[model samples]
Target: METFLGVDYATLWFLVIGGLFTGYAILDGFDLGAGAWHLFLNTEKDRRIALNAIGPVWDGNEVWLVIAGGALFAGFPVVYATVFSAMYVPFMLFLTSLIFRAISIEFRSKEPMRWWRQSWDVAYSLSSVLLALLLGIVLGNVLQGMPIGENFEYVGNWLEFLNPYAFMVGVCTLGLFMMHGAIYLIMKTEGRLFLHLSALVQKAIIFFIVSFVITSVYTLIYFPHLSDRFKESPALFAVPLAAFLSIANIPRLITKKKYGLSFVFSSITVSMLLIMVAIELYPAIIMSTFDAAYTITVHNGSASEKTLGIMLLMAAIGAPLVAFYTGFVYKTFRGKVQMDENSY
Candidate 1:
């Protein structure tokens, strides 16, 4: 057994970051996906149902983002600084979108005007789209490698990060989340809205699968470095393979009216994608476009053993508490969502 202090710092950091990502994907994923159903819901009643489907859970779901960022800052300061500084603009945009999303949800109930409600809905949905795309672009940049100088700082300009590969990844991420939200809507609501969400989910899944394949091939070809990793460790493919299988089962699960199962599979797909990226970037918390040796490793990026030990202890306690609270909220809000005429 590895002692907490003796464990590879890089591995531990990876585990922390990975856990946060997985939790976020499973929790925020449905809420984001629920936003996708916003477009399909025509009636005011149906829209309210869509909103309430995620209302109880969306705010709580965002806690994972905080956890993920906190883990990065504490466990992998180098990575946190490098990625955030290099991707500052996009990160800001992403953050702004999240802010709008929160504000929209909060103020949505304060007004009964049609325009006010509609504006909030647009803000919520648009924010979802931007957040999804930003996440994808960040992943794409990581997989493709960043331009880090001798001092381990990002040397590339903002525009340099906006390549075709990154753009495709953004699209893929957006489509996947939309599909995820659709599945959640199907599971959480009933009536015409539920059926409409189901159909939308199916379509979104089809788009996601097709785009994912194309982007995968493009990523492999353009980023031969990533392909080399796969060649050295063929097991890495298992992540995507698992994702593919889960995605394939989504429709079947939905057809049987297994909404929870369908959402589970969709969440699995996102989790597998995160695992795949983490695997591809192993040992290098921040890769350098100039030279692999310039890349930041776990050992180099980590805090002191004392700091990590303290973090581990806190995580052991806090992580479970967060999980318990999250689970409690979800359980408390389970079952079909109904929206009254005056509902927020």
Candidate 2:
């Protein structure tokens, strides 16, 4: 195994993959959250503004997912193959929702008829919510542990993926996204829409808090192992503490009409929570419910040292370019969305 800065190449790639997915969650999460709020807006104009708020950057945000997938394939092909094969149904549904989401955005504006627009609006919102839930559900199953038999093959029934813990996690994820999206919408609108979102953000904050509390309690009671790392290493507690503070601060910022900061904290909340998950499953990417031996860790699942090293070099060169491009796009489209001819 190649060593870089006291960490092995596989560990480095694990961090890289985690960072990529975290970026995706922070970037794409807001838009999906925004879309989840679609049907809640009263009028067509409000819906249009909501849609256009994410118009410029939604597709670009998805690029992180594509990159994350590629990185998974490159860095840990075994884990990728095993998990994807195991969760094929969920992933397929996720991909289908992504397609419908894109199509809804593009097709919604093509026809001026009310029925056409409404149909796409429903599709857009439903797809957005479904996507967020599915992501959480998948993560939940990963954390709760999958039933992998010999050769890393899934041994459980397909429907087993929808167990209580996974469903709860999915709900929590939806709540978080909704809160995050409301804050983004608040930052990007003015007048009536802003006021509406302002009121709605309060509800979103409560939704997230309730869901978060329930999920945390459930995890501690049912899955004590997830917290063993933090208990063993007191310093790692900082991540969860930071996550809590970040979440706690959201309501305060929202009350002060400091939406920009609220959005920042929302992003922080997402990052901190994911970081906590990474901390919980440091070496293990996926746990095996059936047997400990089948659990996939960075060491057992990574690519060759040379392959990882070369890929790390390429990632070093490419990641910055993608970050820069993402930043440029956001900077270019900053501020309140204006309904022009090109707007979604």
Candidate 3:
């Protein structure tokens, strides 16, 4: 129970792990979103523009996922073991989508045949959509709570994950990513494609807003505990307030033709939403459906103090390097995408 300025090592590591996953969601989210939009573009050039828009950064963006997974394993091995064991089916599907996403990007242009390109397009779009939905579904189930029995093992069958709330959350997540991806694409294209994306951006905003409102209403009705923190401490209300404003800013920015700002707002929207989730679940990383005593909190789920301290030191070095690298990549690739011989 080593304390850093009154906060225990476990809490500190919880913040670190949360930061990593939030980074993953914001970074890789748009790329996945972009991939999900592949089939919507009309022409070969438009499709290529969509593909190459994310080309320079998709792989690098995905590095965040790897880091997040490793950080989860390192910081909360028990949580990882329990959750992953329960989520093997969805996890496998997620992995499969990721593989197809990568291959779709790589193999799309390797041949000139119409059927080959079309097949890969379907693979790419479907996988990207599936990946986003699956991520959401997993998050939804995790939030709803797990049935842990005997030595912290998940006792429920996989079908239990297909509950209505989880599926609604999945749809909401897909809508959010689609909106996010469309905004990113707007920042990287112009003329006819921009017009196409411009039209799509407005629609995406509506789609996301509708999904978010429904989900929020559902949570308020069925999951009242999530809002307890904000109700108990009015100051913590700023997280949701900030999230609401960020979400509101997107459509406004888009109307003003400020796509870069719109994209920034989209990223902020994602980060703020996740922050709200962290606030809601603070301490309890996973809640037990069967009984309150079985809840897994930051205090109960962290690694050894020595292990955490050493890992924190390593993370101190590594996290900034990753941030700097991510920033440099975005900076170098700034502005609208233009295809070249090396483009995806």
Candidate 3, number of clashes: 0
TM-score to native of every candidate shown: 0.95, 0.99, 0.98
Clashing pairs in 2: none
Better of 2 and 3 by lDDT: 2
CA lDDT, every model vs. true structure: 0.82, 0.94, 0.89
Which regions of candidate 3 are displaced past 4 Å? none
Question: How far out, in Å, is residue 46 in model 1?
Answer: 1.3
Give model 1's TM-score versus the native structure.
Answer: 0.95
Best-matching candidate per TM-score: 2
Error of 2 at 274 (Å): 0.4
Model 2 scores a TM of: 0.99
Q: Please write out the lDDT profile of model 3 over residues 1-344, one tens digit for every residue.
A: 69888988888898998898888888888988888888999788899989988888899988989988998899998899989998899999999999999999999999989899999999999999999999999999877788987667888998788888888899888888999999999889989899998998788889889999999899899999888888889999999999999998899999999888898999999999999988888878888887778878887777899999999899999999999999999899898888788875
Judged by whole-model lDDT over C-alpha atoms, candidate 1 comes out at: 0.82
Q: How accurate locally is residue 86 in candidate 3, as Cα lDDT from 0 to 100?
A: 87
> Runs in model 1 with CA error above 4 Å?
1-6, 340-342
Candidate 1 positional error at 89, Å: 0.5
Give the candidates in order of lDDT, highest first: 2, 3, 1
Worst 10 residues of 3 by lDDT: 143-152
Of the two candidates 1 and 3, the one with more favorable TM-score, higher being better, is 3
